[model samples]
Target: MNIKKIMHVENLTHFYGNQIGCKGINFDLYKGEILGIVGESGSGKSTLLKCLSGEISPSAGKINISLDQGGVKDFLSLPEQEKRQLMRSMWGIVHQNPRDGLNLRISAGGNIAERLLNVSEKNYSFLRNTGKYWMEKTEMDSDRIDEFPLSFSGGMQQRLQISKILSSNPQIVFMDEPTGGLDVSVQAKILDTIKSIVRDINVTMIIVTHDLAVVRFLTDKLLVMKDGIVVETGLTDRVLDDPQHSYTQLLTSSILQV
Candidate 1:
């Protein structure tokens, strides 16, 4: 079977003032494939993610993404309103910090319901039941549905964010350091939950993380970036186990040494 390319990014480059964010990046994400972008800090992983997700516009590039309805679109060239609609409808983003993705003032269920609402879901019973279902899927306690996310543990809050993002049934998700800033145990649980959920859904994902273990665990393809460019790209196992690029080798060695 021919793989369907859901997203194609070519010559994607961005700059923070004069500093390069990402330069000459090109990649294609297939339907239901999880792609990982791994690099050290300031290597432009986050910058490239933001550009792809449309949180920030790049200096120049082409981001051709297939919409849920039909046909591919250059999201960067779309009108602001259309872009905003696309983000809410067909795409989801999981931020490194849970606070960046969740509305602290809202109840846990409310947060999930918000995404459903954005997609024009108005039936209260369906929304409520879907919210509970997602909470359960993320390994979160369904009893805490009415509680505020701020009252939940850090790990639980992250799970809530995941539930919210998945509630809308997004075709694609962009995750930046999904397991970052948590203890070893917490990170392991979160990674397991993410891996399990992605396996059960037909969602394509592009995740940016410095964690080699995360790439190995959750991604099918991997890109190793250095100084704003992708230095290596291949099967996750091949690239991680036998990296060809010097930068990729150095990165793997440094992680192993730690």
Candidate 2:
């Protein structure tokens, strides 16, 4: 089956003053595909994700997105309001820290409804029902709809964050270390929920993480970054099994050997 291309990035580059964040990065993401960017600290994987998601502007390059409503459009060239509308309507971003992505003061259901509100969903009963639905999908107890995220565990908070984002039915999601701060058991459950939800919804995603096991489990395609450049890119299994780059070999070996 042939998949439609959703995003095309060409010669994307970003810098922080004199320091390189990412340079000459280019890739294509297709519908319903999960692409992983994996590297150690300071490797620019996160930076690349930010540039792609339009959280930050790149120093140079073009980012074109194929919208379901119409033709391809330049992501960076869009006005701030258009970009904001695009994010609220068609895209979602999940931050590494739950606090960063979530509003701790609001009830879990409120958090989910917030996304709906952003897209101008108004019916109060409908919003409540949708929130309850997503909570159940994320394995969260709907009865706790009124409970604030501040009282939840790290894992639950992350689950709430996922539920909130997915509730919007976004075409593409950008995640930064989705399972970064959690116990192994908790992380496993969260990951399973994420995988199931994405599969059910057929949402495309770009996930940035340092965990090889994470990328191996969640992504079909992989990008390995080092020193602010993509050192290798290939099918996840192929790259892990027979890495073409020395850095990639070291990464896979170091993780598996641990």
Candidate 3:
């Protein structure tokens, strides 16, 4: 079966003045596929992600997205309002820090409701029910819907953030180190939850992280980056088991030694 392509990225490059952020990045993301970008600090994985997710503009590149309204469009060429609408409706971003993705001042359900509201959901009962449903889906406590995010533990806060993003039923999700800064057990649980949720929703995802284990567990395809370039790209298992590039080989070996 041929999977439909959801995004096409070509020669994506970004710079911080004279410094390279990411250069000549290219990839195709398919519907419901989870693609992982892995590298050490300053390898340009995060920079590439920010550029793709519209958090930052690229210095040069083309990002074409297959829209739900039945057409392909250059994401970078869209007006700011159109980009914001796309972000609000079809795209969801999960930040490395849960606090960065969530509103700490609002109740947990209110956070979910806010996203639904952006999508033009106006029924109060439906919004509350949907929020509770998503909380349970993310393994969060539905009863805590009224509680502030600050009152939750780090892991719970992350779960709540996931619930809020997924509640709107977005087509694509950009995850920046979603499991970062968590304990081993918490990481494992969050990863499992994310895997299950993605499967259930059939949402496409691009995740940037340093952990090889994360890519192994959650991603179907992988990109290995170094010095602002993609050094290798392939099926996750094949790349991990038999890395070709010197940087990729060293990266896989280092993880084995850990």
Cα lDDT of all candidates, in order? 0.92, 0.92, 0.93
> Which candidate has the highest lDDT of all?
3
Q: What TM-scores do the predictions have?
A: 0.97, 0.98, 0.98
RMSD of each: 1.1, 1.0, 1.0
Better of 1 and 3 by lDDT: 3
- lDDT per residue, candidate 3, 1-258, as tens digits? 988898999999999999999999999999989999999999999999989988899999999999879699999988999889878868989998999989888999999999999989999999999999999999988999999999999999999988888888898999999999999999999999999988888999999999988999999999999999999999999999999999999999886553
For candidate 3, give the lDDT of residue 101: 87
- Give the least accurate 10-residue stretch of model 1, judged by summed lDDT: 249-258
Off by over 4 Å in 2: 256-258
Tens-digit per-residue lDDT, 30-119, candidate 1 = 999999999999999999998988889999999998876769888799888987887786788999999999999999999999999998
